[model samples]
Target: MRPRSRHRVDELLRELATWEPKELRELQAALGGLQTALERESSKTARQPSPGHIEEKYIQRGNKRHGPYLYLRYWEAGKLRSKYLGKKPE
Candidate 1:
């Protein structure tokens, strides 16, 4: 089977960018497949964290409710470490 193209997945991100305040469920559904792909990529063991964990952090950063925090994943000592991810709102 052919791999899915990033362009196709990018549609969801675009949709999310303009996503309505009230259509979160629909937005999530649109992005769900992309989200899963990101998770899978992040989990590759060469020196990365699990995809699920990475997705969690990405979602955290994307959330307006979180406001002040930024999120990141990094490799160190053969482990995927999640730090403060982002700062708390003042």
Candidate 2:
């Protein structure tokens, strides 16, 4: 932590020692609620998608092009793989 933030936290903690048991319990409950909320939010953004490239592909048959589908090109286990997403525009 930065020096200023550390000083503020230390000062706040020192003041906590002077609080009564009832006040401390209330503080603990409030902090517990806040901690739960923060953890829940943290887990949500943590499940990120693997880094990859989105490509548009098509297949030619006779005299026609079949599709312009979306594919995710990602590397795994020392090999490249293409994951089909959908036939959507880029």
Candidate 3:
């Protein structure tokens, strides 16, 4: 990997070490859910769209517009979709 990519990987590893047990569990559950969804989609007889992709983003909500919370963005049926991941850590 390039130096920049290596540095980012190391930084992410360090950040992961700081996560609380609950946070880690949430991440694990999210990944497991993704896996299950993939498996279910594969078993369906109906033609499915090409495998979608995911990206991290921040989304805003509420009347006061009180966010920019972390989110997972992807494509489904050629439409963009997102799932909230919670607020960005300080």
Candidate 4:
């Protein structure tokens, strides 16, 4: 959290300390539900896959054109790599 948000949370907790026991219990239950929802959202996004990009490559062959080959390009291990999808029919 940012420094400002942390300060706000700190101030809120101080205020909570002065609340009645029944109110504190209600706040605890509400916080538990909020925490569960946030965790579920976090995990859902963590499982989604990124499809970097699609690229095409072209080549010249014996006075004829051979290209527009397709590839899936992405970054891995701090390096850029490509996975061949397919090539145009000869």
Candidate 4, after superposition: displacement of residue 65 in Å? 58
Off by over 4 Å in 2: 45-90
Please rank every candidate by lDDT, starting with the best.
2, 4, 3, 1
lDDT of 3 by residue, 1-90 (tens): 579989998998899899998877656555654554466556765544433323345445554555456555444435555566677667
TM-score per candidate: 0.23, 0.42, 0.36, 0.44
For model 1 the TM-score comes to: 0.23
Candidate 1 deviation (Cα RMSD): 14.1
lDDT of each: 0.48, 0.64, 0.59, 0.63
Clashing pairs in 3: none
Native-vs-model 2 lDDT? 0.64
Candidate No. with top lDDT: 2
TM-score rank order: 4, 2, 3, 1
Per-residue accuracy of model 1 over 15-50 as CA lDDT, tens digit each? 777867656654343344346445666665454323
Per-residue C-alpha lDDT of model 2 across residues 1-90, encoded as one tens digit per residue: 479989998999999999998877656654544444445546665534443455679989999998898765655444555557688754
Error of 4 at 69 (Å): 48
Total clashing pairs in model 4: 0
Model 4, 31-65: lDDT tens digits are 54444444554666553334244567988888988
Each candidate structure's count of clashing pairs: 3, 0, 0, 0
